[model samples]
Target: MQYLHAAISETLRLYPPDTKACRVDDIMPDGTEYSPERWLEYGTCRQENPFRFPVFHAGPRMCLGKDMAYVQMKSIAASVIERFEMNVVAKDTCPGICPR
Candidate 1:
């Protein structure tokens, strides 16, 4: 559960929802890298500073459904992981849209 939360946090950090609305500069040492362990401390998801990681916005203007959104995301992710096996088909190639 902690790892899952950490993974989600890392994902949001790299690709925030409000990328266009707000510009958040990556401050972490390996900010551009996908690292779930960065969010975890002593095997738990550390509470992030809203100002630094404003995925749900910060302070009073923050989103009200933030907690609910996390719950829904985790639930769906868990369900999918439990039911299916995911594999990387191509290691070196970048995936691109193919026109039909």
Candidate 2:
């Protein structure tokens, strides 16, 4: 379960929905690398600081459904993984963010 959560976090970090830069120095070590292990410590997922990993926004304006969203994502991901075998057709191709 923790690995699943970490994978999701890594996925989000690699491909954030909104690319709006906040002026903060890159606090993430090896920010460009996709490493789920960074979120794990002693076989558990570590809670990230919202300001550093603001996928759900932060502070007073943080998304109210953040917990529910994680639950839903984990459920869906588990269900899909259990029912199907997925394969990346283009392993050599890397995804790039398009500017709006």
Candidate 3:
């Protein structure tokens, strides 16, 4: 469960919903890269200032339901994953029927 959250956070860290929206009060540009490990060391999802990863927007222009949205997303992902199993297919394998 923890790793799932970290993976999602890392995804957002690299590709934020809004990549460019100007600055609100001089933010340090040090979080442009994806680092899932950060979530283990620090609860960036629950802690830290929102400015560090403002995917929902910034300052007064930010989304009011941001927190709720995350909760809903996680819930849906967990439920879906629990209901289904995902597998990795080898690149060399043929997916279609091999008629002899």
Highest TM-score: give the candidate number.
Answer: 1
Candidate 3 lDDT over residue span 16-79, tens digit each: 6765755675445884556666665443334446688777767898889987877887898888
lDDT of 2 at 44: 77
Those runs of model 3 whose alpha carbons end farther than 4 Å from true positions after fitting are 19-34, 42-46, 85-100
Query: C-alpha displacement of 85 in model 3, angstroms?
Result: 5.5
Candidate 2 residue spans exceeding 4 A from truth? 19-31, 85-100
What is each predicted model's overall lDDT from 0 to 1? 0.81, 0.82, 0.66
Task: Residues 39-64, candidate 1: write the lDDT tens digits.
Answer: 87767678799999889989999999
* Ten contiguous residues with the weakest lDDT in model 2: 91-100
Please give the lDDT score at residue 92 for candidate 2: 69
lDDT of 2 by residue, 1-100 (tens): 8888989998987777787766975656555778888888766789899999999999999999988988998999988888987788898664332123
The whole-model C-alpha lDDT of candidate 2 against the native structure comes to 0.82
Which residue pairs collide, candidate 1?
A: none
- Cα displacement (angstroms), candidate 3, residue 36, comes to 1.8
Poorest 10 consecutive residues by lDDT, candidate 3: 40-49
- Name the candidate, 2 or 3, with the larger lDDT value: 2
User: RMSD in angstroms, all models?
Assistant: 10.8, 10.6, 11.7
